[model samples]
Target: MQKVVIVEDFCIACYNCEVACVATHSRSEEPIKAYKRENLRGRSNALVEVNGPIAFSAMCRHCKHPWCLDTCISGAIQRLDNGIVYLDEERCVGCWGCVLGCPYGVAHPNLKGEEKHAFKCDLCIDRLEAGLKPACVEACPNKALIYDETMEETEGAYNR
Candidate 1:
């Protein structure tokens, strides 16, 4: 399964994750160009918390038994065996059930307020297919976010 473990002991609240998320998800989809603007918030992503030693940064957990997939009567949300979850916008009914069902509150609707539909992290599946890390993981100067599929990479998450 695709996942990221963030090491809070080393995080500096630099917001590299937030910016990288926007760049990877933006309509332009270019990190260099995206950084030229003042609107880091322009993309469909968010930063979680900023304080506490060992404080965790969160995104889609892709639960073993997903409440989002269960509550979504429209069948918009589904999980793959590898444990990455995604919402099919075409099949979605603009129902907020998935958003409500998500324990982590990762699935968001109308991210920028202009968009009526919702979206969330799919573990940056596109980048993963290209043999690259998620943008947030690559952008972190502290290397707090480690994108890996092995059991060892997930040790930090379990400890938390």
Candidate 2:
């Protein structure tokens, strides 16, 4: 399965990945409109962490055994045969079970809408199907985020 691999050393903490993610997932599919008009500043599936001089981008690992899928009370989380973990917002009940169960802490609570729900990186399934790389990976100027297709499934929370 293809996964987004982080190269911490190459990260510049520019937040390009986050902006790209919001734009890609936004209704308008435009960066300026997504942030200014849609007010989707914090809705990016990709997150950037900065500590001192160290920084790196993070998203869902799409684990072989996803805790989010296992703990979803409403059955909103499902793992596809291609290994992509998906969250069906319409079926979500705001239980936050997946949020609590996600070891990577990537699962987020979507409180911006009238009905809240849990969300995380979907690995840009739509973009992937269209033969395009994830927004975050494509937007990284330094190539810190790589679309790695040769990654083998591993055991534990970091599995992909």
Candidate 3:
């Protein structure tokens, strides 16, 4: 499964990934327009955390055995063969079950309108289908986020 990995030493805590993530997920699909539109609220699935001089981004790990999938009573959460865990908003009941079930605390409630639903990173499946990296990974100016690499390659990267 392709996953985003943090190169913590390279992170500058710029929060660019968060901004890019929100823009990509926004209804307007533009950072400036999304910010200006009150009804077009967007939230970053990836959250930046700073501890002393260290900073890292946190998001869904898309676990092999996702707790959110198992705990979802409405069956809105499904794990694809490629290991992407997706939430079907139309089938969601806004029960916050996934929110509580997610070990990484990545799952959140959609608060845009009267009707609520669960939200989280879908690994930018649409972008991946278009042969593009996830917005967060692509926006990292410091190259802190790396994705779609073999285990040996990842180990070699850090070894350097």
Clashes of each: 0, 0, 0
* lDDT assessment of candidate 1: 0.72
Worst 10 residues of 2 by lDDT: 151-160
Give the alpha carbon lDDT tens digit for every residue of 1-160 in model 2. Answer: 5678888888899999999999999999999999999888789888899999999897898888899988999888998888889998889999999889999889999888666887799899999999999999999999889886776545433422
Error of 3 at 86 (Å): 0.5
Model 1 TM-score on a 0 to 1 scale: 0.80
Candidate rank order under TM-score: 2, 3, 1
Judging by TM-score against the true structure, name the best candidate.
Answer: 2
- Candidate 1 structure quality by residue, lDDT tens digits, 1-160: 4677666667777777877898887667776666565343644444556655544456777677888898888877888777888887778777788889888877877654544666777788889889898888888888677776874533234453
In TM-score terms, candidate 2 sits at 0.92
lDDT of each: 0.72, 0.88, 0.83
Which ten-residue region of model 3 has the weakest summed lDDT?
Answer: 151-160
* Candidate 3 residue lDDT tens string, 6-52: 78888899988888888888887787776677344457788898999
Cα lDDT for residue 46, model 1? 43
Q: What shift in Å separates residue 54 of candidate 1 from its native position after superposition?
A: 6.2
